[model samples]
Target chain A: MKKETLILVTNDDGITAPGIRNLIEAVRPLGKVVVVAPDSPQSGKGHAITLGSPLRLNQVDIFEGIEAWTCSGTPVDCVKLARDKILGRRPDICVSGINHGANHSINIIYSGTMSAAMEAAIEGIPSVGFSFLNYAYDADFTVPRQVAQEVTKKMLETALPPHSLFNVNIPDVPLENYKGIRVARQANAKWKEEFDERRDPHGKKYYWLTGEFSNQDFGNDTDVWALENGYTSLVPVQFDLTDYRLKEKLEKEWQFQ
Target chain B: MKKETLILVTNDDGITAPGIRNLIEAVRPLGKVVVVAPDSPQSGKGHAITLGSPLRLNQVDIFEGIEAWTCSGTPVDCVKLARDKILGRRPDICVSGINHGANHSINIIYSGTMSAAMEAAIEGIPSVGFSFLNYAYDADFTVPRQVAQEVTKKMLETALPPHSLFNVNIPDVPLENYKGIRVARQANAKWKEEFDERRDPHGKKYYWLTGEFSNQDFGNDTDVWALENGYTSLVPVQFDLTDYRLKEKLEKEWQFQ
Candidate 1:
């Protein structure tokens, strides 16, 4: 008999969040599922790992009959601890998030959800991060759940390039209005950040980070375009951050002594 | 008269670290410098931002005459807060670190140093992240200081492509042994992680993250190779994580519905 496929599930949203629960339900049937995720929400944690402190990992009976562990660290830390301690061996595939909000465009860099998946990719595991457009606690996961199932199934069946992962974002639409998934590039866009400055009771100033994502890229093949057109965007992502074009340009034209 | 260049300085190392002080000194003569950095060390913070709570920014007099602020958040948060609240306008350039240790190869993704610079790049500012191979608190900054000066001068003189940043790693060598800078690519490498599990005073188990840098790629043009060969490696980096080749391959071969 063939060995059972091992699937590691995690998210930036706390393990108890409805999003990860939906993600777990979506991929549980595909393999022997194991979950190691943050005990609290770690949404904007990006690719952070806990370096200065020890991490706590305890098994929880949150997902019935599923081996689930809660970690007192960021999402990326959950992946690292899961691989080094809990799983003991690399899983067949790692899936992170049916995240509460969209992680499309430049949000991937600031997203703990995508960063967890990216960390798995760095470890040479085939991985994917799924995010829903809606940010509400009671946001409908019907569409995201189905999308996760499809993407997770395809990811398991397909042979992806090494050190690569997928960023999948589902549109907030009913099943009837759902457009098929589109293979797209990351759009050139950014958050127009504005710090909401307010004084505390002690009259000391504190600031809350707020931003509106402004997309200026008019490219039709970009993730923003796909998501705006009501399609679930699937952008193949990698960990190599080098800009080869600029490297080549500098090599030819610039004088470095 | 030409307008003074407003340079924003920051680091993963706290505002008081010798690394950030050397960085501030390196660029001080080149522009009107403003320093905004973490109040505590945030070494492996990557691209994390403070979201669940508000951030605190307080003015500091550690760097005499040079304006600086200490933020109660990660390195990336320093850049965001600086741009939106502290500076009230985008700085002409952003420079992060002369970090205490190497941020070459795969370290960039886990580096608070590089991520702070990356945050500036994402905001459309030209930026550079500098790291030395030394991990000592009192590591000699003479060489890295000179390197920062040369690179900053070149960066200010040239017209670089927008939305890109540089990751510069200096070899741990004295000035006499230093080879010139080489524009290199990020080496494909990863940390071979081992979790050191121990029982706490309360008899509860906790784990410390430990790892060894493992480099398998033997490419001569990689940053790892440059550092090993006694040269400072300068890699032009970008935030777009999309793997276009894989995206094209999946779009053509895989069936997604």
Candidate 2:
């Protein structure tokens, strides 16, 4: 007489992405699977919730046994809809993405994949967002599945800290030659952005947002370092954006009227 | 002769809101003001950047003496636009809001006001987002203006920590009654959300998002506690979401492959 593990699954790379397909195949064996994700790709959507318009949910059959639904909303909306309308009960664990790209360091702030997991974590559900270093349309995720399953299984056995969740990024490697997992902090990395200016058909100008990932932190404890050293990086990410040490410093040092 | 300070200004309640107008008035004397803000309201926008579509910009004469441009995008877009398109050089300081509502704790994650400031901080500009607890259209600005000026003046003189910005929340008190500013940490606070299900004009069920603020942390060191105590709260917020302590703990303790 034990409670069944209700795992709420989602992704930012759309429901049709092979990443989610791989994720669904992996997690289906462990729990009652409910796949609720965006009907189309919603990468880099951040922590956006659909408040300006009506969100529509369409019941779709993407995975064979999984009760799947595609949402015309962001990845966070999928979790919201699943919590409100789709899921019969509150899910025990929420797993978002086997995203087609890396969502490490500052990228996690702008990632719809991790945002979905953050949403679940906010609701006190244990969650993790999985991403691969590869950004290809058909990236190999065979190795990441084992990493995801291992982490997901561990979280299922023991609850994660409610204030935080995992942002897991796997290095781009074939399954046979994949390195092991590494628990590390997110690297102090950033995207050095440059907007590519281009002219449209109507002779107007537009910009394509482009950026280079810059990592200055040489710490071996970072997720970036782990990935570089041939390992699946697991960064414990949190929603609390406060810098506690700086707070005390400001209080003691700054002049206040 | 001192180098002319470059100040980048933006808001969440649209470029034309009374809040931003008041903000422009306050900062006009301090430096070379460059206003780049959303043409429309972008509340609860989180950290959204315009990636899918081409961003549009329109020059405006709203702020009289200031060089201003309206962006057909989110608040973050306005900051990015200002950095890439409008600004003659990198801004020395970035100031966001005079928002009519408080963005104290968990609210910072969903605030367009703070996101704009955070975007600037990511680009290495000394930045702060000012907000008042009053959520009315014509909330009292007498208090927020003073705090904003103080914080801005201080940041202009002294550089803030890289990748860090301030989340300044003023109390909804009269200027005379205010207890002054207090550097604090973001409280462990959240909204107790309850969806009000209503019938739309088309006889379809819809939900109006409604929530009540809940402050779980009672410590005086928190932003919420400072606001409640009639002190202007200044929390140094960082964009990096990594939980470093948990990383060490997981690495040493957790059973991982």
Candidate 3:
């Protein structure tokens, strides 16, 4: 008999979030599932790892019949500990999130959800990060759950290139209005940040980060365009950040003395 | 008369670290330098931003005749806060680090030093993140300072492409043995992680993250090769994580339902 597929599930929204629970329900039938995630919310943590302190990992009885562990660290740290301590062997595939908010465009760099999946991809595990457009606690997971099932099935059957992962974002629409997935590129976009400056109770000034995401690229083949057009966007992501086109130009023309 | 160039400086190392002090010194002659950095070390913070808490920024009289501010946040947060609140304008260039350890290859993904520079690049500023192989607090800044001066001058003189940044790593060799800088790609490398599991006084188990740097790629044009061969490596990095080649193949071949 063929060995059972091992699936590692995690998220940046903490272990108890409805999103991860919905994700678990989506993929549980396809493989033997194990979960290791952060104990608390770690939304915009990016690729951060805990370096200055020891991490606490305890097995929790959260999901019925599923081995779940909670970690006191960043989303990336949970992946590291999961691989080094909990799993002790590489899983067939790793899936992170069903995150509470969208992680499209430039949000990937600030997203703990995508970073956890990216970390797994870096470790040679085929990975995918899922996000829904809704940010509410009671956001509908029906469409996201279906997307997760379809994407997860495809991933297990397909052979992805090494060190690559998928960033999948679902539009906030009813099942009837949801368009199929689109393969797209990351859009040229950014957050227009503003600091909401205010005084503390002690009269000391402090600032809260706030921003408006602005998509500057009008290309229809971009992730932002796809998401806005009521489709789920699936962008193939890579970890090698080298700008080869510019690297060649510099190598040939520029001089460093 | 030409308007003076404005340079924003920051690092993952705390505001008072010798690394940032040396960096400020290196670029002090190039332009009007403004320093905004973290109040505590945030070495592996990656691209994290402050979301859950308010940020504290305090003006400090650390460097004589130079204006500097200390922020109670990550390195990337300093860059954002610098642009929106402190500087209230875009700087000509943003430079981060003279970091006390190597941030070459896979280290870039976990580095607060590079993330700060990347944050600036995403905002249309030409930027460079510098790291030396030495991890000692008292590491010699002789060669690094000179390198910073040369690179900063070159960046100001050249018209770089938009939304790109440089990751420059120097070898720990003596100045006499230091080879000139070489433009290279990020090497395929990862950490071989090991968890140091131990029991606390309460008999509860905790784990400390420890890892050994492992380089698997043997490319002569990679950053790892340059650093090992006693040369400074300059890798131009971009924020778009999209894998275009894979996307094209998937779009043409894969069936997503």
Candidate 4:
């Protein structure tokens, strides 16, 4: 008999979120699942790790019979702990998110959901982060559940490109109406940020971050285009941040002392 | 007379830390500096932004004549707040850190210092993050101070490539022994993580995350190689995480349904 596939599942929406629960149900049949996730929401936490504080992890019965632990750390910490403490070895593959919202385009820069998967990718594990375009707590996971099942199944059987991870985003559409998945590029887009200034009860001023998503690229091959066209967009993500084109430009044209 | 070059300065080691103080002094002569930074150390905060909580900023006089503000947020949040609130306009360039530790290679992925600079780059500002290979609270800033002045002068004179940010890692060496700066690539590296499990006074177990820096690549044109050779490593960093090379490989090799 073949060895059972070991799967690690985590999310940024805390352990109790409907999103991760949906994800667990969708992928449990694929392999033995172990979940280590943040005990509280870590939505805007990028690739943060806890250095100044000690972390606590407790085994919980939150997912019924699933082996799960709620961790007091960032999404990345959850993955680290899962590898070091829970698994005692690398999991066959790591899957993060089924995030509460879309992590498309430049939003990936600030996404804890994507960061967790990226951490696993850095560890040379084939990993994928799944997100629904919907942010609602009650957003029907009917579409993402099917996408997760399909993607997780495919990932189990196939090998991803070396050092490359997947950012799988399902468009918020009825499952039957969804078009097929498209491998796409991240669109050149950004949040046009605005600060909402408000006063506390003590009259101290504080600011809340708000933004509008602005896609400046019209590339038909981009994730924005795929999502807008009713397809599940899959973008290959990596952790190398070097701009090779600009490196050449800097070397020849700019002088540094 | 030249218009005063507006410079935004921040760090992951917090406003009162000696490292940020060194950074402020180094760039003092370059421009009209506006210092906005976190109130406490946020060492492992990557590109995180505060979304679940409100942010508070207060004008501070800690740097004598330098205009500064202590922010109740992460390093990335300081940059955003600097742009929209404190500066009330985009600064000519943003410089983050004479960080308390190394941010070369994989450390950059978990670095709050690099993230602050990355955030500024995302907002289209020419930016750089500087770090010492030293992580001590009282580490000598003699080398970094001179390097900072030189890099700041050079950046003000030359426009960096569009959307380009620099990650500069200084060797923890004497200024006179310093070799020339090398424009390099981020080396392949990762922390070999170990979790020290210990029991609390109340008998609950907790973990302290610890890691040993492990450099895997033998490439000479890497940041790690540069630092080991007594040269400051300058890697032109970008926020785009798409693995184009792998994207191509995946297209030709992997079949998706």
Candidate 5:
């Protein structure tokens, strides 16, 4: 008799979202599933960790048969607390978010969903973050779930490089329309930010952060190109932020005493 | 008459923190200093932005003659708000911190100080984040200021590559003990995290995030090595998180249909 695999699941869209629920459902048959996620929506929280206050974790009956916990912290906090407090050890692999929105390119920099996966990678766990291009509350996670399962199975069967994780984004298409998966590079895409200014009832000036997607990278091998062409994009993201090419250029040209 | 160079400054320690105040004073002579920062401390907030709620900006007289505005958001929010609202136009150079603590190596991923600068880099503004090895409320900023002055002058005189910024960390040593400046790489270091799990008065378990700096990289050109040798470390950081080497490996080996 062989022991069952342990699969840890988490998301940034709070414990009540359909995305994580669907994720648990998809991965449950493959392993003993455990979920630890944020209690409230933590979109765009990035790689934030709670430092200003103590964190409280509560056992919740959200996912009927699954052992789930709600953390009163960011997505990264949930991963850290899950590793240090709940699990007491690292799992076989960690998976985060069948997220309701895209986690491609520059968006990953500000994404709590991918941040959880990055945290898992930093802790030496093979990690993958799943996201759909749709931003609606009831966005379909069906295609994303199937893709996640395939990706996760591959991750478990094979070993990834040390300190590396996957940023997987599924286009908002039906299963039949899915054009398969492509391992692509991060697109040079960004949000052209705009703030909607308005006066409060009490005459205070306030702003709402809004933006539009601007993709200038026309490279056929980039994530944006793949996703736009109806394929799911899988970018192997790393924690090292060093620009080696620029570093070399600076060392040669911009020298200082 | 030459136009006064507009310099945008911010930090994670809040608008009223001594670290940001020292930053303003140091950069004031080089430009028409504008300090748009968080109203309260936002340490370890990473690249977080407030999307669920509205943001308010208030003009403050905290820096005396220097122009400053307090934002009800994270450090990254301050930079975004400053760009969208206050600055209205991109400044010649964006500088964050004189941070009270070190943001070298992997710490930059969780640093509100460096995130603010990264936000600027994403927006095509040449940026730099300065951090001190000391993490005291009243850590001496004298040597940090001198280093910052030299760095900012070079930035103003040189043109950095697009989407690239500098992460500068100064050692907490006297000027006489300094081993000079080092154009270093980010050390492959991490925090050995320990969760101090304790029970509250109500008998509920909570966690306080604590960690020890684990420097495993023996490279003499790393930021950790430079700081340990009493040298200010300057590492050029970039926003693109793609591991090109890993991407090439995956492309050749892991061909998914």
Candidate 6:
């Protein structure tokens, strides 16, 4: 019997999105595919789990030739559910997104796409989150498939670092004109959050979230630079949030009684 | 004239929670306090931000001395909003939470309390997140006052490490019996996520999120250990997710074209 690879699939864009459909199509030939994704889009859910309320999981038939389930929880919930209840066994690999928007720079801190991948990595499973530079309802995902396919193939053959995962973002370019891949650092970019204040029909004041992406780091070795240059950006990410350099200094300065 | 200190205040337990009110009381005398927080409870929202829709802000007269506003967003959003819209200048200090529960070990990843502080730290603001090791709707916060005051004063007097913030969890003991503070590391502990399946009144199956906290770490210097020993735990955390030790190995193994 061939070593059947169990590829756990999920996304923040919900199960019915074209991105996951494309992902499922590409990875179906590789091995056994199991998709546990949110029933609705969970774009900025971050590392959130479903603790506030009860979660519901229903068997979904959104994608053919793949075992699928829709979760009434965040992206992290999908991964947790797949690992504990659905798979019950350790999966060979986990892949999240082909997200509609970029999970680059500071955006990673708020991305449901990267959080799903981070959840898998925290569980000691090799995982990757693929995203696009474009943020639209129907952004082009043509170039993403080829890059995503190649990256997935490489990971299936070789293992990633423990407690580490990839935040891969592809430029919104055509497949034919796309440059290759680039291993880069997360760019020091952030959103200058500006809310668009407006009034509802009932004259109730409301605000819409808006922001301008500001890239401060002009280094060529960053994911933002790679995306701007039309290359596939792969930034190695980890879950250890400790500021190790500050640790020793703090220990020495602060008196612990 | 006293130098007008810009203080940014936020919380995970919603803007109306008693926790933020207690926090506001502690910090109001020290600076020009600006309270921007979620309209509803966002306890487990993590580092989430609103990406799909616009965020709303409502000016509410809650706290008497502090300038408070409720945001239609996550805890991280409150920080961002305060940074951009509310504060006239860059905040001298940012404080999140007098949280109802502990943000010990890996729980910080899914904690909106810590995330609000982490967001400010990323923006180069001196930040601290204060939590008590108790989970109750009407938990007593008296024990945390001295610890919170000390940490806040220290951060104010001597600026904290850039890209670093405090994750402070006070012991749940009485004020007199509480052991002193401890400079600690995030314990290598995690929630063993378990889902409790039950049938809804509408005849559909639902699952309640349940987890048992597992701490296999035996190190005395860990946060969990400190908290268990009746000490307040302060762990300095950062946003750079790079595992630099593995960088050289990954660079050699995986070549990016």
Question: Residues B1-257, candidate 5, lDDT per residue (tens digit)?
Answer: 96678899999999878888788878888988999999999999999989999899999887779888999999998998898888868898999998989999999999999999999999888999999989888888998988888899889888666766999999999888987778889988888788899999989888999988888899898999989999999899987788788888888888566
- Point out the higher-scoring one by TM-score: 5 or 6: 5
The value of fnat for model 5 is: 0.83
Q: Enumerate the candidates' DockQ scores in order.
A: 0.90, 0.63, 0.91, 0.79, 0.81, 0.64
The residue pairs in collision within model 5 are none
Better candidate number, 4 or 6, judged by DockQ = 4
- The candidate scoring highest on lDDT is 3
Q: Write the per-residue lDDT of candidate 6 for residues B74-100, one digit (tens) a residue.
A: 898888877777786889899999998
How far residue A121's Cα lies from its native spot in candidate 6, in Å, is 1.3
Error of 2 at B137 (Å): 2.2
Q: How far is candidate 2 from the true structure (C-alpha RMSD, Å)?
A: 1.8
Model 1: DockQ score = 0.90
Q: What lDDT does candidate 3 reach at residue A160?
A: 74
- Please list all clashing residue pairs in model 3, or write none if there are none: none
Over B53-126, each residue of candidate 1 has an lDDT whose tens digit, in order, gives 99999998988889999999999989999998889778889999989999999999999999999999988899
lDDT of each: 0.93, 0.84, 0.94, 0.89, 0.89, 0.84
Query: Could you tell me how far off, in angstroms, the CA of residue B77 lies in candidate 2 after the best superposition?
Result: 1.8
Interface alpha-carbon RMSD, every candidate: 0.8, 1.7, 0.6, 1.0, 1.1, 1.9
* CAPRI band for model 6: medium
Candidate 4, superposed: residue stretches over 4 Å from native: none
Report residue A255 deviation for candidate 6 (angstroms): 3.9
Over the stretch A1-257, how does candidate 1's per-residue lDDT look in tens digits?
A: 98899999999989889999999999999999999999999989998999899999999997888999999999999999999999978898999999998999999998999999988999999999999999899998998999899999998888777777999999998888888899999999999888999999999999999988899899999999999899999999988889999999999988877
Model 6 score (lDDT): 0.84
Compute each candidate's TM-score over C-alphas: 0.99, 0.95, 0.99, 0.97, 0.97, 0.94
Give the poorly placed runs of model 1, Cα more than 4 Å off: none
How do the residues A1-257 of candidate 2 rate in per-residue lDDT, one tens digit apiece?
A: 98888999999989999899888877877888899999998987888776677666778976887899988888987887788777867798999999998998788888899989998888778889999888888776778788888888888887456655999999997666677888887787777777787888988776777778899889998888888888888888878888887777776778876
